[model samples]
Target: MSTPTKVPLGSLPLPLSSHTLTKNLTPDRTAASPKAFRQVQHSQPSTQRRARLLSPETHFSYVAPNPLPFPFKIVPEEGEDVSPANQAELIERWLAAREALQEKDITERSNGLRLHFPAGREQPRELIGLSETGLRDCLPHLDVGDAFDLLGLPRLTKDPTNEEPQETENPARRELIDILSGYATLINVEEDVDKSWAPWSLRYSGHQFGTWAGQLGDGRAISILATPHPSNAELTYELQLKGAGRTPFSRGADGLAVVRSSIREFLCAEAMHALGIPTTRSLSLISLPELPVLRERIERACVLTRVAPSFIRIGSFESLNPPESMFFLGGGQQEKDLEALRILGKWVGRRVLKLEGIKWREEGQAGDAWGRQLVLESARRNAKMVAGWQAYGFMHGVINTDNVSIMGLTIDYGPYAFMDVFNPYHICNHSDGEGRYSYQAQPSVVMYALRSLLTSLSPLIGAENALGNKAVSPGWAKDMSDEQFAEWRKQGNDLVLAELEDTFQDTCAEEYRRLMHKRLGLRRIDLDDESKLIRPLTSLLAEHRLDFHSTFRRLAYFKPSLVDSPASTGNLESSKADFDAFVESLMALTPEPQMVDTFKAKIDWKKWLEKYSERIESEKGLWDADEDVDLQRERAMRDANPRFVLRQWVLEEVIKKVEQDTKSGRRVLGKVLQMACSPFEPWGAEDNLSPTDILDDEVLEERRYCGIGEQQMLGFQCSCSS
Candidate 1:
């Protein structure tokens, strides 16, 4: 292991002398009560401590030759212009908000932790925490200072927090959207900008499998900013900076994410979101040009600001264990745990699962009927989430407890991939050499993670009530208690049944077998009749190892009569005409002559064609004409089976672009920010299909290779590398 660097917590560089601090302003002396005065006195020391911490030299190194760029700019909030008057008012409001939050003790915590508000400043810059090596490494290729020049944004010197600030006709509300839309880049300044701002975060820890992994806080990331949805203001989005520097929980490692990994995360999040999978959103990717750090061979690093409804991870809860445990804010020990779980569960159930009116109550408590409902809803939502992943052929390489979200949103994108080919088992992570996270193993892994999370809530579930903690025990009606237990059992059973159903549905079965035979130019087997379907399918499965997708598509188009009939001399001329036409068309694409011969040996082509025609005529309804039946066949032929996949390869290509730019020291700031702000719309450029569009044979070949690998591989690493 490499030696870790010493990272310092910085101070805020606000112009306090020139401006009165809003948070510390004295209220009207006569209006203040005695109790209020006492409270102020009690909190005075901490405020002084914060002020001391905010002083520049104590927190930062003034490296002048590499002076930081001014991070904030004035951009349009809407299409409306930003006038001087409006700007002044906006700044005042922002200042007041910041002060209010601070007065309520919402500022940065101890150590290097800080909050960052992208829209709070005039020109929003990426928050550079003490452990921000990732941004520093990518600064060479990225012009952090001039990132907004092409997007029609201008530099502004006036303070955004001024009480009576200038306003513009069109002022940008936040830089996150522009950066994501390929419009701006976030720069970092060491001397100026408030270092007092701490990212919004929750403390948590968890059990890794059955073993306790204590106090696993956010070792690298922080939620620094938020943006409310324009139309529905009630829904707010949290913008978190990953690898933005160190925090109290840094664990002696650089708090930065490598470019290679950052790109993977950015692309994967976007891909999953597009595929309709629940996942965290990537808002902006910023590269630090100056700070260099070594990771897997000194590669450049980058910071990705991600957006999500909540940043609550399983790890967050886990961190608040015995040592960090505190009061439940209003009540008893178990009460706190129960409340936390209930709140988190309800949010997950409603937002991620689209389930409304989910309720919860503490175990052994009177109102636990609601709690039971929350659990069931969570299970159903999780079941659907797993099914969606399977449908898209995606494999989440890592299934760590900490990585699993209560909301079922995929997070911490690492070695992951969509199956290139049809394989029952495929693994994506090379590190997971044990195949713990395989393509076929995801469902089980997810279940295991869920089970572990539930176990964490055991304390709240009153597991120790049998031992008699009078304060925690509810000596209520047995009927109510039994009902809660029964509900859990029912939900558990339903979850199992759902998983089984998904597995059964995903198996291609008869359709898959038929397609394989068709692709290999084998005799077409009739599936309409059970006997006919069984015999030929078995024979083909035994004879050749055919791929599921290719086989299914071919069977969808196969003309069975072409292989089951042969020519007789009595009608050789007409039979020969039809046979020649079929052979010519078939041979045009068939690579091996033996394949055609093999097909021919299995059936009499001419005879079968005659029989097929006769059967079609006989099957026609007594009053209906045979022409109608013929028309149906024609229509089926015209509607070709979909031979192409739109999800996997396309996503891979997009991920590749994101990865390349990140590696080359060009920030994906615009790409990610746009995605975070408007997840449904395409970001940047008119042509939105660059990743999916095929430019040449090589591109097709690459996709073919990826598809095939996906099918045959097992385990996270194996699948992802392939």
Candidate 2:
């Protein structure tokens, strides 16, 4: 196929200002002649000498390839006038427009780099028949390579700028939006894409597993690809490539992601997002037929286009060489760092906590009390994030500095699992043999990561006063330092650490209480006075070995309200009620609660009821009746009280499906993906309350085998079954 020629529609109507080209591009070495270079450079009228230096050669050029590979069709909505011809024309026009921009020679003078989007050798699979909105969502697949390109650099061609038009209605805007939206929908991705892109990323380095690595960047991911939302143009969905290729920070390793790992990542990302956890969404999962990666064994390679509010991690800033110099004393670079920090802090405050700008201000504070507010907000979000993880029984397995998000969203699903059994010390990843990231240790792991981040931010904020301006403020005495900032950070860290310990203690106490209540046939104790509940519960558990889940679920039914309520129990004495009804219902003997024996259990029922009533009365006295209690706080406490865990049964169901597929040569991978995608929901229709309907021991054992050796077992099964 012939390369499409650029067709210039018209020049930009506005007069080009010298300020437009603030960053100078490097000269092209392959310029046909110096005169040609001068002609291109001098094309724009440059009133300022600095602007004259920023010739077209300094600008980066990127173009979409013609004759896309994917088969797609456009389906316009009702009353929409987007005909097939118009759709084709729109695509053609887009291709032509992009080509024109790419052909323009751009240079980066400081780096001596002529930025050019050299067309990829292979054409991407073009998806058609999508509406403009659909196309916007699907752009991730169309431009997978561009996602990888943005990984290494601090800024992309389309950097977030204050002067840029917040909204646009042109064909370019429509096309881009449609493409991105389509990408998101096609890949079943769902995360708030509006707050996804960042111009100048926060740069930092990290100590990976204790080794201080300097200048580590996006090794195999990029974020240049973004399409603004069609309806709200200010919102954009970013397309970041994972395992697309290598960057300056590849660290000698091939930046290729294997298909198995890619599948796991893609599914988990979407799953986490669906479960209402803040996380990066997977827009597209593309298998690279041409690339076979060797990791443990040779496997087919794939690239996942992941969309996130921003890819800025604590490690990003830590990896930079001379991080303190870059922020405090550096030239123009410090401004970028400061801006990034502020943006990150604001995002944590607003997006995570739902806090408004006005709430950040303090009564006595002046000049951006937002920083202090930000620290508290970050702490709250981090605590809640831990709680969410606990509720789902999710073990991140590797809560490294690089893996944690400033937004407190869980990203990078490597070696992650939903816990099967409630073993706090259970480590999912065999590689983490040291229990660095065990189920119970995640809170501590997260705290450590946050401390490292705060440590990195200390210099910028002034280590002494917990205020960032002290180091840079001229009014401060030369002798005065950020010593208070250091102390404040230590205090903040201590508070967070203490909170984590408290949370873990509560978790343990709650679990132990439930266990006791079940085995000893004791009524569930109110945790208002944890010491009272904990002492009795611990004693009961020590006295008798009992299953945790069974015990609590049984006791939950033994409520006095059921037997003593006037409406239901008025004629109980005349009806000759027996305790069998209570026992059978309490034991979950019948699927339907009404079918159980009608007898009310009388063994110490009055005593237990009195204790429960007394606890309630005591709580009311302890807490002022007039005082408004935060219902959300109470709900959070209730949620934290270990209930049903989705991971326990979903894993079993997934493993069973995998086993069946392996044995029967049937493709049940979709079901597995579905299970992972909605980790919180039960599988199948019959067992909506249960994780999975399958309960046979033999089947479970087979499924367990399938899960452990999924890749090999599936291949073998496919071969034999076929």
lDDT tens digits by residue: candidate 1, 1-722: 33223221111122221121111222223112223322332332122111111111011111001101112123445655468777754543433222212222234433223322222312223321111122222111112232243222111112233232222322222223333221132222223223222222233555443345544445456554333333344454555667654433343455556555665666567556654567777644554534454555554546666667666665543432222243322111111233334344434444433455433334644332223233344444455566566544567777766777766678777677665433546666776777777777776776665555444444433422322322223422223354564454355334444443344334323433443332322333445433443334423322333333333333333343433334433465655565556634323332233434545423433333344444444444632364654445433432322233323333444445444543211222333323322332212221222666544543343334223234213222422312
What's the CA error at residue 528 for candidate 2, in Å? Answer: 2.3
Clashes of 1: 97
Q: Model 2's lDDT to the true fold? A: 0.40
After superposition, candidate 1 runs with Cα above 4 Å error:
1-198, 317-368, 459-722
Task: For residue 539, give model 2's deviation from the true position in Å.
Answer: 12
Rate residue 575 of model 1 by lDDT: 52
